[model samples]
Target: MAKSANPLPPRILRIIQRRRELGLTQEQLARMAGFSLSLMTKIERGAADPRHLAAERLLNLSRVLNLPFLHLVEDELPEEEAETPPLKVPLYPSLKEAQEKKTNVFVPLASPMIPLGATPDHLAFFPFPGPWLVGVGVPFLKQTGYLLVDLRPLYHPQGVMVVRFGEHAALVTAEDLTAPKGYLLSFSKGLPPLWPGDYNPELVGLVRKFLVDL
Candidate 1:
């Protein structure tokens, strides 16, 4: 047999096997799991190691595959040390910067913060002042805190969204998306709404939940 370009890891093999048994194509699994099709292909074909995938991805994959999260993590753990760090998610300044791979840090979802279910793509924000959120028109979220966001584009529901342009990021009521020109962007009292000639905005995230505490 010709040598394989990418040797499949044991975990990758199992994951691919499970995907086949469930009759899910890579694109199907990627869409269902809220990730990119390209990434799903790389993982299933062993071009990427499953272990190195972000924590929430592994969790999502395990959940979809009917496998246990601990089992996947502990596969690399030695017998004497059974404990592993809690699953983690990354923090970014804005959805635009996140798309550019600019991030602040990774925060672990352990202890008190464990209940918030965030995807691996772009989880939460580094704590920003509530004033900015007010400017974005989300008065209810008017306090310095972390905001959980769904970074997957296209699949995002239209409405209150966090968006960025040039160098600014804020929450806005967006409509008329996909116009020949640009979307209609509105802001809170403190900020200006974007009109036709204004800077074209890029969607950073669809606001999922607000994390008021650190």
Candidate 2:
């Protein structure tokens, strides 16, 4: 009699193969996926289930492998278990505070810059506070409200600015400082702490710039 093939999902095999193709050790893959090496090893061995963000991490790994996202889920799900929803836990106390206050945090709408996708629930900061404009994406947007701002002018001036969206706010910055003063302005209408006609462009810009930079 012929033996039946192993029943693990394609995602598991893809993870194993992709890790090898990229020359990534399990430790490297784990760090990229925000998981521990032991956890990754367990999943590869089929000793654990990949649910919620685990699935997302697997998807991301597939991307790094240049494989199709659905390639990981090629097998039918077990009849008894349905796919789980994405986790919406807050990663910071400020997000929790914003949610408790029932206020929304404003964030830049850029897809790559926003970790929670197009519609985020937490307020996120950018440029991550440094000499250079480096930034980190986060997933705590579900706990706070979100908004997007256009920072084209600021980018030219190497200037920074702040703006409010619902109950949350963000600071934006540029890489150069040669842009004209007052060239940047908030365009969000009906936003609170509403910048009156006499708004302090420099101070507002500085405040918005520093908050996220920190």
Candidate 3:
């Protein structure tokens, strides 16, 4: 086998070793990090260097792995012109374009307060003051909280969902497409009627779990 060209930091190597010691799979780690499985695969193989991780993702990896953030810090490696991988960004001129070309697409799922950039084994926490969740009426979450929106359950009935339509975004209880779903974006108002036309909004993901502070 050809010797790997990328020399990863000791800390980065330790992360992989520890995860295996704990018997965690790359997919589990990616879900914990709120990233796609492909991202985790790249990181483990040193195809995606930790030095390239965003600040928030760095913190997330530290928290999830129980490793100190500073201890794992490493300077970026210089990329050889021929060895650099093209950056994948999600952007599309229209919904049709996004569904068609399926390349260089970017989605603004992260918020300023709560960002998503971490080892695929970390949690993507959104810090929005949300009544974005429904069905679970824990009093502790009445004030402020975070939600784990899993993209895998978009079709699950009664599951909460995060949706975007042009400039508007909302969290709502999902109902049959034939029936109207209520928008939970507002905290002070009564259940608002969601027009059926709104059903076609960009389905970001399903609300899998939530955490809140009283």
Going through the candidates in order, what is the number of backbone clashes in each? Answer: 0, 14, 16
lDDT pick, better of 2 and 3: 3
Backbone clashes counted, model 2: 14
Q: Which residues of candidate 1, in runs, are more than 4 Å off?
A: 1-85, 94-97, 110-118, 130-136, 154-159, 174-200
Which candidate model has the greater lDDT, 1 or 3?
1
What is candidate 1's CA lDDT for residue 74?
37
lDDT for every model?
A: 0.57, 0.41, 0.50
Candidate 2 residue 174 C-alpha distance from true site, Å:
25
Top-TM-score candidate index: 1
For candidate 2, the TM-score is 0.36
Return whichever of 1 and 2 wins on TM-score: 1
Candidate 3 local lDDT, 1-214, one digit each (tens): 9886867766578679767876889898777866688988888777777757876676566555655444346434334412333222243332233234444532222222222432221223344454233322222335455555443325456556655555444555555333444323344345343434545767765555554410
Off by over 4 Å in 2: 1-5, 52-68, 74-194, 197-214
**Tens digits of per-residue lDDT for model 1, 1-214:** 8875856655676677878899998888887766699989987776766778776676577656654455444345344333544445667664545667676576555322343444554555545553233233354444556776666442344445766655556565443333333333333344444434445667666666555442
Clashes of 1: 0
Candidate 2 local lDDT, 1-214, one digit each (tens): 9998667676687668878989999889888766788888888887765543444465455445554444455445443322332323222223224334443422222222333322344333333221111111122211222223222222223434443333434443442122232222222453232223343333122311122111
